[model samples]
Target: MPTTFRQHRKQDDPVLTVDFTRFPLAPGDRVLDLGCGAGRHAFECYRRGAQVVALDQNGEEIREVAKWFAAMKEAGEAPAGATATAMEGDALNLPFPDESFDVVIISEVMEHIPDDKGVLAEMVRVLKPGGRIAITVPRYGPEKVCWALSDAYHEVEGGHIRIYKADELLGKIRQAGLRPYGTHHAHALHSPYWWLKCAFGVDNDKALPVRAYHKLLVWDIMKKPALTRVAEQLLNPVVGKSFVAYATKPHLPKAQA
Candidate 1:
């Protein structure tokens, strides 16, 4: 997530990283959307009949998320038995009992936090044994390009602090006592948008190139044109903006008498 004007808008559709097909969300599952920036995943989980909790440190985002969840409920968007909650909280110190959640998702958030492993440990602690986790981070290559292009892209407070290579992140997941089952990349078409932003200026969304690229991204996301979709699929492995990994908290072994 680059420090851009894009962060301010309420995304009509979630900018998804974890594919639902791979990390399935069952009905009534207790899901924690840790560091849920704009409650995108939380809203999806709610629509899927899960008991969803969207937690973030930013109270403003939390309030807006809560409103959206409420609106969804009033509009009958969430199915019967699906519940959603938005709360302001810290990722490093989750305010939940041990084994509290059936699923946890932290998307495009760890890179902003300094103690990435500490956040992982907390997520592992709250997740029930055999529960699944979906973790997403900015891919190193594209992120490095943004950094090289402009300092303002990531130098600000609450901006991305580090990029994660696939192996390095997988190793951390293992260290956190989770067994990684699957991994993938997403938002391949969105990478160039940030590169343009960095080259022009992180805040200069008005730049002609930036404006043009932004429209292209908005078109792809909202309209989902077949051409761009196919192009994204082809390019994801090589230059996806986000790296997604799915893992499970291992159940402890039984002891012999």
Candidate 2:
């Protein structure tokens, strides 16, 4: 049976990487977090005063995310009028009508699905004209190193099926009828941590180097140390662990009959 692995995800996500300002979400905007693994981005959207829908295929994850949503509501972590909903759904065929959402987020999810283009199509289908999307995938070089280091790093069930080059991913977004606008890399400090884990053993949490690096990551995430933040920002362009692309659905010019 698959465990929740809640302990494995203690660190808050790298919010700066998503750069929500570029997406231009406003209060009451409809936001969909496709494949939201535990509602990290969804929660952020809610906090920004958007109506957030956190969708995932994993029932267990959805349940956990729903609990978090309720907790956030009870604790007033979200904005005054914000709302959130967590649901189980298929990414390839979203249960939404065309042009339904103002913003869509599919973070660190494309590499896991074999039919990536199909999933992109579904995201595009659900996005309103002029809507924006942010897609994140495991960067090619760093992910290649992890794959080279250990088969277990990605050869497991539901693991990343492929690595995506930045250009290749951008092209797929364009093919899906979205206009590519901006791109960035993120989590540069995390590349070496994964490399260490892959070098020893993916599951060897007790390994000294792995444990130390994990601690460092936890600190970097929780503390926001100035030096490490500066270093990560500098290294992100060169060796970030993930590549993020932002795109918008183009509004077609009116047809002349």
Candidate 3:
């Protein structure tokens, strides 16, 4: 869904946009990672002992994820009751039945699709009552800067089609019949790296500044030293690159006779 430099989640530990501390997961909970590019979040959920289904329209990525899941299972990376599945499926039409999942996550996926509301509706439909959902997108300010700097950044197919402000996204969640409880920004440090990419060329990873920034991000994600962690936390509220929101589906009232 996201064709940005942030898609470089190839590390042993995936760089997750959702903070599990806030959106907690338990063992055996049914979890879905819609638009699960590279199976980053799905891998994390598997490790956390959830029954995970990583779905994506990209058949190639789905195959790769399935391989990794098998490897994890064989290696005992996932705990005793944790099952994992990776399948190619459309976000607009999920194959699961109603009230099928305890948690649903769609990160960096909504902006690429034209019918954002349709995607939200599908998420609401599949999530069980009281089940949680996390949605993340490119934040408005940083995304606007990238748009201003480079048309090539968002003009390509499967690139980000729209940047969303926090309130706007939360409102859509409410409209989808989910009650949003909390929200925050993430990846403040990576914003500038993307900005640099936009200024240079989205595909030109060989550029000097882009290459330099790429090293810094890999180091930050891998080692996660105190300095960058603290810096990202402090800067997140202001210039963070991605906006994350957590919501839960509510039970319906009884019908009148």
lDDT of each: 0.90, 0.87, 0.90
lDDT of 3 by residue, 53-87 (tens): 99999999999889878877766678999999999
Compare candidates 2 and 3 on lDDT and give the better one. 3
In terms of TM-score, how similar is model 1 to the real structure? 0.94
Per-residue C-alpha lDDT of model 1 across residues 204-228, encoded as one tens digit per residue: 9899999999988877676767898
TM-scores, each model vs. reference: 0.94, 0.93, 0.94
Candidate 1 worst ten-residue window by lDDT:
1-10
lDDT of 3 at 121: 91
Given candidate 1, what's the lDDT at residue 16? 70
Task: Kindly report which residue stretches of model 3 are placed more than 4 angstroms away from their true locations once superposed.
Answer: 1-14
Any runs in candidate 2 off by more than 4 Å, and if so which?
A: 1-17
**Inter-residue clash pairs, candidate 3:** none
